[model samples]
Target: MIIAKIALELTDLLVCAGVFLVGSVISFFLFHVALRRKREKLISEAEAEAEVLRKEKILQAKEKFFQLKAEHEKYIGEKNNKITQSENR
Candidate 1:
């Protein structure tokens, strides 16, 4: 009878252990899913910021190009005026 009682106790212990193991596995899966979502959000935000920076850089470059073009045209105009004056003299 004592042996039967011990066997029953052992079975109960094993069942409890199995329950604990299953709970742990479920928790681990939930934690991993949450972390994956967080990582994706961070990556998306970084990509958006990078796109904004790229657009700003392009706009700055275009503005600089226009300024340089205007300066070049002014220089050419001045040179032409000087040559014409000298030829008239």
Candidate 2:
């Protein structure tokens, strides 16, 4: 009778342990999936921000180029005017 009781108790313990292990595995899988999704979201946000910054920098560079070109043209015109005045005199 004692041997039978002991065997029954052991069987119950094994079943409980199996259930706990399965639950842990499922929990771990769910956590991993959540983490991956969060990471992807962060990466997407960063890429969008970077694209905006790149476009802004390009616009600023174009503005700078235009300003420099205007200055150069003004300088050349002034020199030409001075030469024409000297020729007239």
Candidate 3:
């Protein structure tokens, strides 16, 4: 009768251990899923910021190009006026 009691106790212990292991696996799986979602959100935000910066850089370059073009045209017009005055004199 003592041996039967011991055997029942052992069975209960095994069942408890199995339940604990399954719970641990489920907890780990949920934690990993939450972590992956957070990581993806951060990556998406970074990509959006990078796209805005790229657009800003392109706009700045275009403005600089227009300024330089205007200066070059003004310089050419001044040179032409000087040449015409010299020819008249």
Candidate 4:
């Protein structure tokens, strides 16, 4: 009778331990998935912001190039006018 009682207690202990182990594994798996998704979202947002900044820089560069081109053309026109007046005189 004592041996039977000991066996029942051991069986109960094994069952409880099994349940606890399964619960821990499931919780860890879910936590890992949640963290990975959060990381991906933050990376996507950062990449989008970087792309927008790059486009803005490109636009500013194009504007500066056009402004410089205009200024250079105006200077050449003034120089040609002066040369023509001197030749005429």
Itemize residue pairs with steric clashes in candidate 3: none
Q: What clash pairs does model 2 have? A: none
Report the lDDT tens digits of candidate 1 across residue range 1-89: 99999999999999999999999999999999999999999999999999999999999999999999999999999999999999999
For candidate 3, what is the total of clashing residue pairs?
0
List, residue by residue over 1-89, the lDDT tens digit for candidate 3: 99999999999999999999999999999999999999999999999999999999999999999999999999999999999999999
Cα lDDT for residue 45, candidate 2: 100
lDDT of candidates 1 onward, in order = 1.00, 0.99, 1.00, 0.99
Q: Please, what is the TM-score per model?
A: 0.87, 0.88, 0.86, 0.81
Q: Model 2 over residues 1-89: C-alpha lDDT tens digits?
A: 99999999999999999999999999999999999999999999999999999999999999999999999999999999999999999
Descending-TM-score candidate ranking: 2, 1, 3, 4
Q: In model 3, where is the ten-residue run with the lowest total lDDT?
A: 72-81
Runs in model 4 deviating more than 4 A are none
The reply for model 3, stretches above 4 Å from the true place, is none
Segments in model 1 whose C-alpha atoms lie over 4 Å from true places: none
Predicted structure 2: clash tally = 0
